[model samples]
Target: MRIIFAGTPAFAVPSLRAAHAHGEVAAVYTQPDRPAGRGRGLQASPVKLEAVARGIPVLQPESLRRRSAQQALRDLAPDLMIVVAYGLILPQAVLDIPQYGCWNVHASLLPRWRGAAPIQRAIEAGDAETGVCLMQMEAGLDTGPVLLARATPIGAGETGGQLHDRLAELGAAVLADGLGLLRAGIRPVARPQPEQGATYAHKLDKAEARLDWSQPADALARKVRAFDPWPVAEAVVAGERLRIHGAVAVEEMHGAEPGTLLRAGREGLDVACGRGVLRLRVIQREGGKAITAADFLNARRDLVRA
Candidate 1:
């Protein structure tokens, strides 16, 4: 099968490589390089870097809705297209170009989390389990029929980054298996998702990173995990921003005013919350590297009460 692979981030690289290994990858389409990081240097997306290293043809069209972009895709003459975290909406015309239709390896199970930040949303919502789903592409937003799915239990203290890596690998395997079935001329039956219990994974916003001590400790801990490595949970401590990287909920009954530093010792930076205490295991001050709560406390003795 001549496959045209489309994706953007590191999460999509695994599935792209799997497709390349399984069949003939005619071309790879990814988002273009953009300014990133402290220096604002142009950074190539992970999928683009992988495709180039593998010697696969690479295309980075700004928009597929344009006639020129659509023509470029048609020129590939691919038998099928595989999309994972592509970051671009495919128009109906482009989705119709491939003979076998495009298949998407979405991070969340169909009809449950169907948007940009599924992995983070699952952890934020304290979902017990979440999984990857291979869906036959459609015009609607992740409303496609499901082809294959692999479920996994979301660990109690799992972070967004960890879940993302696991799901990426799982998605690669599922995509490979789905492609095998397709190659054998077996069209996998589509399962219509239940209309109930559907929710959108809205993109994470910076404002959402601000931690409100008024919330329960468990919820705050989940927020810290969900936003790790991106928009980390933050709070205003002594008129300075403090980012929380790792935290654990304390089960003991000791409590103080919400947001108050209940204790600052070797155990960790135990901060009181509305219903419980949150032990800040790791922290990063503005313009400084990440450090353990103990290290942070040692350096700034004044934070012991704020």
Candidate 2:
């Protein structure tokens, strides 16, 4: 099969590499380079750099809705188009170009998380389990028919970053399996998703990262995990923004008002919440480096806010 691989982020790199190794990847389509970091240097996406290293033809189309871009993709004569985190919607016209049609490697099971930011949304919702789905492409937003899926349990204390890496590997494996089934003349069955239990995974925003200590300790703990490694859960202390990276809910400790400092001890900074205490384990102060809670406490001995 002459495959056209489309994706942009690091999570999509695995599937792109897998397809290039197992199938005939004629061209790679990724988002165009963007300015990154303090220096604002233009940086190619991870998938783009990887595809180029292997000498694959790369396409950085700003919009596939344009006729020229769609024609360019059709020109590749791709038997199948594999898309993973491409960061753009595919119009119906482009979906019809490939002989075998287009297939998408989505991070979450269909219908449950149909929009962008599925992985982070699953964690934010405190879902017990989430999985990857390989679906036949369509015009709607992740409204495609499912071809293959593999389930995995979401650990009790798992962070978004941790689940992301696991799902990436699972997605690659399922993508390979899906291609094999299609090649072997196996017709995939598409099941319409149930109307109930559907949720949208909205893209993460900096505003949502602000910590609300008024909420229960358990919920706050989960928020820290869900937003970790991006828009980290934060709060202002002494007029300084503090990023909370690691914490656990202490059900036994209860009393003071939410957001109050119950104690600043060697073990951990025990912060009061609505229902219980949150033991801050790791934190990063604004303009400072991330460090253990103990180190932060040691550096500022009179920091306890009673």
In candidate 1, how many Å is residue 28 off? Answer: 0.7
Q: Cα lDDT of model 1 overall?
A: 0.91
Which stretches in model 1 have alpha-carbon errors above 4 Å?
Answer: 252-255, 302-306
lDDT of 2 by residue, 39-90 (tens): 9999999999999899998999899999999889878999999999999888
Clashing pairs in 1: none
What's the alpha carbon RMSD for model 2? 1.5
Q: Which candidate is the best by lDDT?
A: 1
How well is each residue in 1-306 modelled by candidate 1, as lDDT tens digits? 999999999999999989998899999999989999999999999999999999999999988999999999998898899999999999999999999899999999879999999999999999999999999999999998999999999998899999999999999999999999988999888887787988999998999999998889899999999999888899965456889899998875654678877777666787788888888888899899889977887888886765
